[model samples]
Target: MQITQLPSDQRPREKLLQQGPQALSDAELLAIFFRTGIAGMNAIELAETTLSTHQSLQQLFNASLGDFCQVKGLGEAKYVQLQAVLELSKRFLQESCQRNTVFNSPEHVRHYLSLELKSRQQEVFMVLFLDNQNRLIHQDILFYGTINSASVYPREVVKAVLRHNAAAVIFAHNHPSGVAEPSEADKIITRKLISALALIDVPVLDHLIVADVSVISFAERGLI
Candidate 1:
């Protein structure tokens, strides 16, 4: 059935306005973003088909331009819009992290890092340089590696911290395998970085391991 033929409250836009965006299913949300559908399918149906093909919103968002446009009702225009939306979300989260003390809101830190790193096809080591107040001063992706490992140099990390004049630091890296567990190598490296930064009187506050679905904290697990 056509979306217009559905009850007013049942339509994606009306449902969003009446109840809130969270009240809508993924398909409903995508339908609103899509605006229109192909000749035979309605917007909701098209969204459902797209989601089914991709398996999940994460997979869809992570798809390359070519891969995304291969969907029947989707094209380059939709792909560009989708990338813009994702970039906006990342920037919004970064702004939030900058405005507040990240240690005070660990979830925000996790969320920001997740968005930054989770979808990456390779391992990326990121450093979040924080002031004494724990507010974010700067962030940079210091190293990029293959699917499983990144070569992180403590000297380079220290140089970055010094360059930013950071008082403290939070280390985060992503595993493309979607397992949040910190490997023995991860532990060894965290210890090395902590020791390296300690000499400069810059404490390593926490180390986070980001996977596709979750973020794990070394400090929380007594690993740091």
Candidate 2:
């Protein structure tokens, strides 16, 4: 059936106006972008066919310009429009990252880093920089791989703090073995970092060991 022939209240556009965008199904939302139908299909039918072919909206969004254009009814204009929206979403994520401050609680740090580093095969270290009020200013990746005394430089940590003008810092590293326990090397490095940053007046707040889905705080264990 043509969109114009559909009952006004039953139409996707009408339902969107009456109930809000969230009320629409995935196909209905995509139908709005499609706007028109081919010779034998309505816009909603074309949208359903496209969604069925792609299997998921995520797959559709990830499709390349050429891939999208390969869809019978999706031309260059529609492909570019979809690509622009996807790029805008990515830009918004980057902007959100810049606005986020360092988290204070050990649990919060674990939660934040878990999404970023939990699945990595190699060790990764991140430094959380905080202001005088203990609010997060920024975070930086200091080192990667099996973190050793030789790899993690106190000078680099100090430089990062100075660059961000941070008042305090938290050290975090992931254990690829799925064990959150700190190693002997971990303790030695924490001690050395705490002592080195002390000379520059930037207190080391905590040293965290992150594993698959757990985190251990050195400060909570009185190790730092």
Candidate 3:
């Protein structure tokens, strides 16, 4: 059945307007974004089919433009829209992180880091430069490639630290393999960063390892 033929209250857009965004299912929300559908399928049905193919919304959004365009009833225009929305959302999150202090705002830090690192196919090392009050100054991805003790150099990190003139920093990196457990190399590098940054009168507040399902915190584990 067509979405327009559905009961008014049951329609995705009407339901969203009557209640709230949180009240709707994933397919319903996606249907609202879709707005229209192919000849045989309604917007809701198309959304359902798309989600079923991707398995989850995260997997769907993380898909490359080419991969997503392969879906029925979608094209480059919608792909561009989706990517724009994603970039906007990330910027909003980054702004939110900047407004709050990381030490007292663990959730923001974790949430921001997850968005920044989780979808990456390769290992990336990033740093959140913080002001004296632990408020975020800026975030920089200093290294991207394979992650290891040798590859993540303290000298380059120290240079960035000096460049930002940050009073403190929270370190983070992603495990593309989806294991949040810190490796021996991870521990070794964290300790090296702690030692190197400490020499400049700056502290290493935490080292977070981002995996798909969870974020492992060295500070929470008593490693910091």
Candidate 4:
């Protein structure tokens, strides 16, 4: 059926105008970009086909321009349009990561770092610098390797905290092995970091170890 022939409240574009973008289904939202239909299909039908070809919307977003163009009735122009929207979504996610990250407690820190570190295949040591109000000032990757006492330098931690003028800092690293439990080496490094930061009057707030879907907090466990 023609989209315009549908009830005004049920039409994707009309519903978007009346209720906002969130009111539209994934296929309905996609159909707005599709705009037109070829023989034997309506715009919504074509969109449904496209969505079905790639099992999920995420898979569709991850698909290359060539992949979209290969779809029947979808040409390079529509592929570019879809690619541009996906790129904008990616950029917005990155910007949101920079802006909206708040580390209030151990759980907050874990949630923030999980989004950034959960997918990493190798160990990545990162530091979160916070201001006097505990708002995040900046986050930096300090080291990327096997987590061990020999690899992390306490002096570098001190220097980075000073450079950022951070009142407090949270340390986090990922275990590629998917074990959130801190090893003896991780404990030793946490002690070293706490001691080094203490000398400069910059407090170590927490040390988190991120595994696949879980996190370990040093402060919560009395390890810090």
Best by lDDT: 1
Model 1, C-alpha of 223: deviation from truth (Å)? 1.0
Worst 10 residues of 1 by lDDT: 65-74
- In candidate 2, list every pair of residues with a backbone clash: 102-136
User: What is the per-residue lDDT of model 3 for residues 59-87, given as tens digits with 9 covering 90 to 100?
Assistant: 88899888887789988888888888888
Clashing pairs in 1: none
Q: Give the residue spans of candidate 3 off by over 4 A.
A: 147-150
Error of 4 at 201 (Å): 1.0
Residue 81 shift from truth in candidate 1, angstroms: 0.4
Judged by whole-model lDDT over C-alpha atoms, candidate 1 comes out at 0.94
TM-score for each predicted model, relative to the true structure: 0.97, 0.55, 0.94, 0.60
lDDT of 4 by residue, 1-224 (tens): 87778899987788899999998888888888888877888888888999999887756765677887778998878877877775575455545444554444444555557766765666889998988767678889998785332278999989899999999988889887778888998898889889988898888878888876588888889987
TM-score of 2: 0.55
Writing each residue's lDDT as its tens digit, candidate 2 over 1-224 gives 89889988668899899999999999888988888989889889889988998887756876777877777888889988987876675455434433554443444566666655555567888898888876667777888766332268888888889999989888888888878899998888889889889998989888888776578889899997
**Full-model lDDT, candidate 2:** 0.78
- Clashes found in each candidate (C-alpha, N, C closer than 3 A): 0, 1, 0, 0
Q: lDDT tens string, model 1, 178-223?
A: 8999999999999999999999999988999999888999999998
Which runs in model 1 stand beyond 4 Å of their true positions? Answer: none
Clash count for candidate 3 is: 0
Clashing pairs in 4: none
